[model samples]
Target: MEHKIKVAVNGYGVIGKRVADAVEAQEDMELVGVSDVTADYRVASAVAKGIPVYASTDEARQQMRAAGYPLVGGLSDLLGKVDVVVDCTPAGIGAANVDLYRSLGVKSVFQGGEKHSLTGHSFVAHANYKSTLGRDTTRVVSCNTTATVRTLTALQDAELLSKARGVLVRRATDPWESDHSGIMNTVVPEGRIPSHQGPDAQSVVPNLDVVTMAAKGAHTQNHLHFWTVELTRAAEAEEVLAALKAMPRIAFVKRSDGVVAVNSTVELMQDLGRPRGDMYEVAIWEDILTVQGNELFWTYTIDNQAIVTPENIDAIRALAGTVEDGAESIRRTDRALGVRADFTATD
Candidate 1:
């Protein structure tokens, strides 16, 4: 029998819980355990799922024990127990913990919140699968970054993309993050141009020139991208749409399909019984795809809530180099997660 990849996820919030669940579903990956600050309801929920829970720090271990949930160990001990440690902690936390991962000799993957420089490699499996081979740490990148690379790289491979300019409609915080979220129904500008997403995408598809603008949306369900790209060749709208549809994790759906809003897209996922209501794809609004002269324009909403889980799965195998074929890993991960190219699969 082949050895399963022993994986541990740190920070059991939205991203960590999803990552832990994904690791469990992979045929060759075993979710060894999860760690987080001793937040009662969340950690208890992790316990309810039967995921072994651990404290995010030594100081929290006692708190966890006192809270009546069992702990396999603390965060330090978690490092010794797994082959890979996926750091889903808040921004900057993963970079802070890099030395620990090195000292323990465990490969770790960080989420996008950390700077790309934190780890030598920034990853988007479709964009740079082979780049992660034998690397000790990998940053799976943020949801916006994930959507950007998936969208542009698809068009790039077809030689359809010359340059991508997008405005990121970012959600303030997750809906479930109510305790610390609630910006008085504000839509705050991110106050930067060529937003971090552009450079982040370059980390994955290093040669591409993609600039982005960003804004905070009132809703917390998903992030939207309003994109205008210059295509190398003039093509019909249908041809452009077909090219995007061929991308591995991009889902094409339109209002004609009876889904009109991003929340509705999410509700449809929940109604369809998707795992944790995850719409793990670039949900392109199909009708908006248009070609004007040399520029191809469109808008799409990415379920920032759930798009990166499968990528996280692929990142695990990439960092480990345990899987030789990137396509094979993506296919298996998608099927396991029910991530398909159309809305019907969710509906």
Candidate 2:
């Protein structure tokens, strides 16, 4: 039998639970346990799934015990058993846990909320998977950044890109948190020009020339992006679509097919019976993609809650050296996560 990498997920919230599930699905990884500060339904769901639950702190342990939840041990105990820890805690919390991981000699993967200096490497599996192999830590860029890198790199790889500009219509909050968080009646523009996503994506593909602006929407389903790209030279729409199709995890949806809006794509995911209606692929509108001279225009949607899950899985393999070939690791992850090239067609 082959040795599997022991994995512990710290923070069983939005991204953590999904990471745990993805780790469990991988043939080359073992999910030792998960740690969280809360003993709410999220942690309870982990318990129901038979995942070992550990308290992130002494207080959390007591809370879980009082809530009648079973625990294998505390966070340190879980860390001692795992080869790697995926830190899906809120923005700055993961940064605080870095010292503990380093002390235990365990590899760590962080979400994009942390600064690039946290790990010095921001990951997009398709773009920079090889660079992370055997590295101690890495941050999987944010959902929007992941989508940007995935698509832009495809164009870059095909020699079709020169520079790009994008506008992101971000979801106000995760669907589950909409009741208590997010904007209600109005759309709010981000105060910063060239929002952080562009620079974050650049961390993965450093040569990428892109600028982005963003705004918060009244909805919570997913984020929508309108891109105006400058091709290296005049190209046909077919040429651009072919480049995008060459990339893995970049799927296509069409307005003509009634997948006209962000909400429709969410409905499509539920209809497709995806776990939690999660669409991991960046859905591009193929039919509407236009090319005029050296400029290209297109739109796509990002499932902020779920898009980065697969990248985190691939990052684990990269960090553990479990799979040396980035493409092979990606193939394994896409298979395990059920990421497909076409979401609209029955597979």
Candidate 3:
């Protein structure tokens, strides 16, 4: 294998920590450093882990260190030092930095909310990694998109099914910082954030059709969302579920008990000992393939932010030719770990 890919994680939030850890776990990738704008407890934690930490300035770094993590310089110095920079900042600000990364000739993988199409491709590590790599930049789909894309990719490729419909009800780890934000004890309608999942999928593999809906809920951890799909073949549900249950990247697939549907994903995360206020556990209910002459409905749970970053790193590896394509990575990683993304559903 090639020398470990040097990776820099740019944002030190929940997703950044997970991404940094995931990078360290990889035999072929190295965590060169971690950076963020503000010095927070998360940054301190990264430093405690022995990863070099840098902020915007020595003074700023000292302030951040007081908050918790030791620091080095500012973001510019950190950016110049790594090969791939995973920008995990919140939506609005991340896009500008992503653009700067591209201009600097450093390949970048961005969190989904930026809603900016800065790169030539969007990636789903297990599904479309090969299609998105080596393109200067790539966007990991939103959490909901990551979950749905994983399922749809398998279905589209395995069963030749087409068309998907989903209703996504989201629970956040914390509320948005806007006073006008409909968070905290409020079930508000934020609608779907503009995303290119449908179009991106079509771009990657034509003849696939999908429609999606989104809602927001109040919580303070990673997002939990659901998807209902319409399949071209109902009888194929069993095979589809079996396939998903066998993928490694997927953490949990619901079991086929009448009382427990895929809706049990959140509870499953709790069982997995996911950190409080974070997304780590996932569950899916392979609901009976309600066949309306071939349309099938099923639901799945996702730890949104967490899903994207690991897969984004995987994408970077593929682009760097450090790993095989997405499908092969799934198969290989499954072999190494002895599990696949698990799937469970009731008939």
Q: Estimate each model's TM-score.
A: 0.96, 0.99, 0.81
TM-score ranking from best candidate downward:
2, 1, 3
Candidate 1 collision pairs: none
Indicate whether candidate 2 or candidate 3 has the larger TM-score: 2
TM-score of 1: 0.96
Ranking by lDDT: 2, 1, 3
Measured on C-alpha atoms, candidate 1 has an lDDT of 0.86
lDDT for position 38 in model 3? 68
- Best by lDDT, which number? 2
lDDT, candidate 3, 260-288, per-residue tens: 53235545544545443333324555453
**Candidate 2 lDDT for residue 119:** 91
- For residues 1-347, write the lDDT of model 2, one tens digit per residue: 67999999999988998999999989989999999998989999999999999999999999999988888889999999989999999999999999999999999999999999999999999998889987999999999999999999999999999999999999999978877998889999999998999988889998999999999999988999999999999999999999999999999999889988999989999998889888999999998889999999999998999999999999999999888899999999999989999986778
lDDT of 1 by residue, 1-347 (tens): 67899999999988998989989988899998999986578888999888998888776788887887778888878889889988999898888899999999999899899998899788888888787887888899889999999999898888888998899888788878867875667789887887888998988888988999898888777888898899998788887887887789998878887878788788888987888888898988888778998898888888886888888999999888889788888998988888878877525
RMSD, every candidate, angstroms: 1.5, 0.8, 4.3
Q: Model 2, which residues run further than 4 Å from truth?
A: none
| Candidate 3 stretches greater than 4 Å from native | 57-59, 65-69, 172-186, 191-206, 219-228, 233-236, 243-248, 255-264, 273-282, 287-289, 331-340, 343-347
